[model samples]
Target: MTNVREAALDVIEKINKNQAYSNLLLNETINKHKLIRKDIGLLTEIVYGTIQRQKTLDFYLDDFLTNRKKIQPWVISLLHLSLYQMIYLDRVPDRAVIHEAVEIAKKRGHKGITGMVNGVLRNVQRKGLKDFSSISDSAERVSIEKSHPLWLVKRWIEQFGLAETEAMCEENLQAPYVTARVNTMKTTVEQVLHELSEAGLDVIKGDLSEDAIKVIQGHLIETDVYKSGEVTIQDESSMLVARALDVESGQAILDACAAPGGKTTHIAERLQGEGYVQSLDLHEHKIKLIKKQAERLGLTNVEAMALDSRLVTDKFEENSFDRVLVDAPCTGFGVLRRKPDIKWSKKPEDVERITSVQWGILDSQASLVKPGGKLVYSTCTIEEAENQEIVAAFLKDHPEFSMDNTMIERLPNGVEPYVDGGELQLLPHYFGTDGFYIATLIKDS
Candidate 1:
């Protein structure tokens, strides 16, 4: 049997030392260690819980710790893992957690270090952590309480008010339900839900999006329904991208920066296998991922190719495609619940850098939309810089395109209230989806 605690320790250490993404590292470690399903669950809880609660864990650890300077990096990871179980996991006995931490520390270090780990943890358990409720600063308190970086919390506070930022950060700590989009090209949403339920998985029709289904139980990707290409695992927020495009049969579309094409396939599905979707990405390997999705969904209308989105004009004639999508990559702050490592991986400067790229990509792809056609610019980020500001900047330079208010009718009915000036910014707390931004523009005839 794999040593589950030791496996958790290895994952935590590697993540901190190698700057590895927690989700990918945990998955790879579980596979490499050949952990059973039960152990895999435990390891996942340890690694992700610790990362999601790192700021708060350190806050508690700092109170009991006499000398933080002497603590080794691995020891810090070990303590973080231990405290995550003790605080968050109710079913795991507290004593069992402490004992495992001691044993892991002893295995990795000398007796002195193990004694320090035991003492600090026990001291925290006995005396309890420092009272953060008494802290006077609201932003700092929220940052520590929600376990988000102070900079990020303050930035969000600046953009969104205190209560909203607090809610967003708190929601970011919660696990998101597995959402999948039904391949309506081959099956209806009701049929897919019936098939999934009959197959012994607990699921429900999604509250948002016409074709989205939530997997309440079972690994969605492992289900036979998925293997049969009846559904594709995607967030409901992402599923809205195709609807935002509102592609029709035989209308050419361009998905600039499309890789692992979720929206691209959705466009092909909407096209009824008649229209061609030029899915472009800078990397050849990622382009393969787009092709793989197209193949899985039996979509023949998508053509995946390696090309830079900034140079779209170099690859094709201007005003050639009827619709275009620029899902510009941002800091990914919106999907923190699914990938907690993103919160720590990004910096304030990254938003600025990506904003520049988003602006460039939107302008470059704008010409591809033929006269009287539409273009949709989107990102899975809640930042105004990448979403509204980019669109605002684009509008100033190009007067031929105007905000398409009719696109609001294309969105999910319940989401119409959020659309203003032909743009929508979905917050995770307010909208039960990944925080996203969508802006639709139409070229004049």
Candidate 2:
């Protein structure tokens, strides 16, 4: 208990003071301390669960802080972490949570602070979060209840309406399943499933993609299929990007924002070892990542280099490739389930900034497509300004490119519910997959 509490506090402090990412810090700190598996699970549960529910926990704690007591940051963090366990973790006994929190306070604080910590948690145990009906404004109340920023909630209400916004926020707090794409270039999904089953791994076929498999449990990279480049751990929604491009054998393709090479490798796999795929990225280090993935997958069709997609016209000739894919950078609000901290880390202004950047990359890469070629612009974001609005604005200026009506036919069957005409915004709550925005465009000859 002591080690778990201490480790969680260390991660919380770093995330607060240094702005360290919660996932990276948790993995690093846990390995650094060499904590056992049980303690590791406890520490991870408390850290993510507390951070995910920080706002709601603080809202509940506000009632117990009756005298306007100015508690230290560490003390507040302790209370928040402990209250998360009490409110959300039903398997955890309330008495044990309060006792562990009080104990943590004593070890980390003085006698006076320890007493206050014990008092606050006990009062919380006695009375749960009172009616949020007092929060008058609908968006504000939903924000607190779902542990999301009020500004974000307000923005979402305007875009998605009340019901869907609430559902999306609630889904962000749930654990996401692990999905991996089988390298269909090397082996079929059926053969991979058979191999995984033989290896004693619990796995199942993905919902949408014929090539993607969802891991029910266990680390995939440790298994022989992954080590041998038979499977790559990628989200189901992400697998749709390469398919959206609909690349064929001997077709030249450009992956404008290829990095860490999930989609780039998928594109290469789709090519079936013919033609060329110039995987361009902004950084040399990330380009190396693409090269590494290409090598691991035994793909020779990919060529990775540090070429900024925003400067695509500057580096490459106009109408150079048969197809271009811009998986644009975004505020990443859509992937909150995989990265809950993004909700707190991002600001409203960031949406405008990234939208501008998305437009710039789109503008530059639009010229890279050959006449009669296709350009697929996609983002793992659900925001209107970044997703639909960005493409709408671009198409307003560039009449040469029109929405690919065939996009609807290209999507896997169960994806029709989320598909909007030719473009689709995969909602987290609706599809049970990572939120992704994929729009296919064809340049008129």
Candidate 3:
């Protein structure tokens, strides 16, 4: 049997040393190790759990280590994996974890290092986590509880207030919900639910979108329903982007920045093959992804292209599209549940840089909308600079475009009044969905 703990340690080392994305690195490690189903489950839990709780684990390590010498990355990762099992996996015996840690350490580190790992982990086990609660500094307390970078925690506390920041941080630590958009072209929401139930999977209809269904606790990708392409895994917030566009038969639509084609196919499916949906992204390789999704969904109306959205006016005629969806790129703070590493990877300066690009794309695409047609600007982020602030600025400069509030009613129920000046912001903890922002605007004749 492959050593799941060692595999997890290697993945974690890669994350810290090579700056690899945790999820991508974990998936690659699992494949390389050829882990069985059970091993894969344990390895995934160890790697992600350690990364998610790195701050807390480090805090405990600090208390146990007397020398305060900086340990190597591999040793740090090894201790992280072992400590995670001790605290989180109550079913696993502490002795078992200790033994595995020593064995793994013997292979990777010297005998002295193995002795140190045992001493530190056992000391933590004896002390328990009671002392972590008494940390006085708000930054320290939030870091342990939320398992986020001190810089990010402080920034959120400033932006969202104390209570909301704590809530957002805790929410990010939870496993992301598995949400899928039913291929309305192949089946109805009810029909897909029935099919999933027959296959012995537990699922509930999404409270936010009529076409979205939330998988109860497991992944929907493993199910035959997903493999056959009857549904696509997407967050409820993302599902709303396509719905906000409200494509109609025989109307031409443009999905700028369409990759992995979630909204692009949704637009084509909603148009029912009568209208043409042109999907564009800057990378030529991503165009294949769009085409692959289109083929899977049996959607023929979508035409994938590789083009920069900032040059849309130069590439396509003004007033050519009846509808346009610009899912602009941003810091992606809104969807932290799925991509927890983003909290650590992003910096404050990135917001300004991405917002500038969003502004440019919005300005370029604004002219492409036919008079009286719809333009939907959406992002998987909750920052004001990227959402309302950008849209507000656009509306001020482009007098011909006006906010449309009626679009909120088109969204699924239980989506609270996130509409601020006709912009829909979905918070992660609010609807058990990824945090997202969408705004629909109409060009006046």
Model 2, CA-based lDDT? 0.88
Write candidate 3's Cα lDDT for 140-196 as tens digits. 698787788787778767766788778877888787768889998898899889989
Q: In candidate 3, which residue pairs get closer than 3 Å at backbone N, Cα or C atoms, i.e. clash?
A: none
Which 10 consecutive residues of model 2 have the lowest summed lDDT?
A: 66-75
Give the alpha carbon lDDT tens digit for every residue of 1-445 in model 1: 1289898888878877777988888879878988888888888888888989999999888877788888888898888888898889999887889998898888889999999999988987888667687778999999999999999999999999999999999999998899999999899999988888888889999978889999888777877889888888889899888888878899999999798899998888899978799999999999999998889888889998998899989889988999999999888999999888888878899999999888888999877899999999999999988889889999999999899888788888788768897898889986678999898899999
Per-model TM-score versus the true fold:
0.98, 0.95, 0.95
lDDT of 2 by residue, 1-445 (tens): 7779878988987787676798899889987999887888789888888888888988888889966456788888888898888887888898998888888888888999899989998887777678788898889989999999999999999988999999999999998888999998899999999999889889999987878898887667888889889988888999999888989999999999998899999999989899989999999999998898888899999998898788877889999999999999998888888787788888999999999999999988888899999999999999989989999988999999999978877778888877776698888897678889999999999
Q: How does candidate 3 fare on TM-score?
A: 0.95
Number of backbone clashes in candidate 3: 0
Q: Which 10 residues in a row give candidate 1 its minimum summed lDDT?
A: 1-10
Consecutive 10-residue window with the lowest summed lDDT within model 3? 413-422
What is the lDDT for 144 in model 3?
A: 81
* Local accuracy by lDDT, each model: 0.88, 0.88, 0.84
For TM-score, candidate 1 versus 3, the one ahead is 1
